[model samples]
Target: MKKPFRKKRQGGFTLLQFALVVLVSSIVSAVALNRFEYYREQAEIAAARQVVASLRTSLQARAAQLLSTGRERELQQLASANPMNLLLWKPENYLGEYYAPDPQQIGGAGWVFDPRDRSLVYLPRNARSFSFGSSKLLRFKVEFVRISNKSLALNQVSG
Candidate 1:
């Protein structure tokens, strides 16, 4: 007896299967991109905070040295000067001292000292989640605050 012939099945994915795979891949990519951005912003914020903490400590140490050396009158000047100068090792991102950096000159995430305003400006390169308010740069100033009845401390202020 003769056997009946049967059609051969295709070897590749069907059109609908291919479409589904592409859609799933695109979704995964989008979600991954969003998460990556969030983590990047968080890391930037943490690094900035570390720099600020170091600055505060250095300021206090310098003030103490001044007091010990009978240069108490110069503490006020120290508070007004560039805080970065007190750092034994500056961050790699620091763009160095700038009187008043032109917007066109500074274009990236880094630290800069603007003596004109007596503020340290942090220019965020990838600031998707940072709270910059009205401007892209986050500004901080160093000032002396009374910690107790007879003691003062150096602190960083956004204002």
Candidate 2:
């Protein structure tokens, strides 16, 4: 008795070809993901800026309303007061009524106002990961544009 030999059939992808394709695609994927993460962070930063702008507008509007009337003493107090510490407890004040700053409203950034310089500050919760002097440096710089009684100017961040 005699047996006959048969040839093997070829497949779609060989081991080395598959490995090369996977390696190339993985490197490309890594680069794309890195870019995507950067864009996402930028978006978060932009959202934070917008939130600060809204808050500044409200504060300026209130300040204008207060200054327009003959309530200099009360307006002075409100300007010097911290919106969060007092407004959270009491929304109504001599300047006018306003809501408190809620972190949840601004994606968890703790909102604080510096009456000395009149700058609205917003720092991401993950502040430590930003810069070397993250404690002293503000990742986002907010400007009230104008706090006069004519019209409220939205806050703009200095880049």
Best by lDDT: 1
The C-alpha RMSD in Å for every predicted model, in order, reads 2.7, 8.3
**26-56 per-residue lDDT for model 1 (tens digits):** 9999999999988988899899989988987
Query: Candidate 1 at 77: error in angstroms?
Result: 3.1
List lDDT for all candidates, in order. Answer: 0.78, 0.51
Give the alpha carbon lDDT tens digit for every residue of 42-152 in model 2: 765666555555556566657667767866556555544554433223222112211433335545444455444554455455554443242422422222344343333
Instruction: Give the local distance difference test score of model 2.
Output: 0.51
Q: List the residue pairs that clash in candidate 1.
A: none
Tell me how far the alpha carbon of residue 31 in candidate 1 is from the true structure, in angstroms, after superposition.
Answer: 1.0
Question: Global CA lDDT of candidate 1, please?
Answer: 0.78
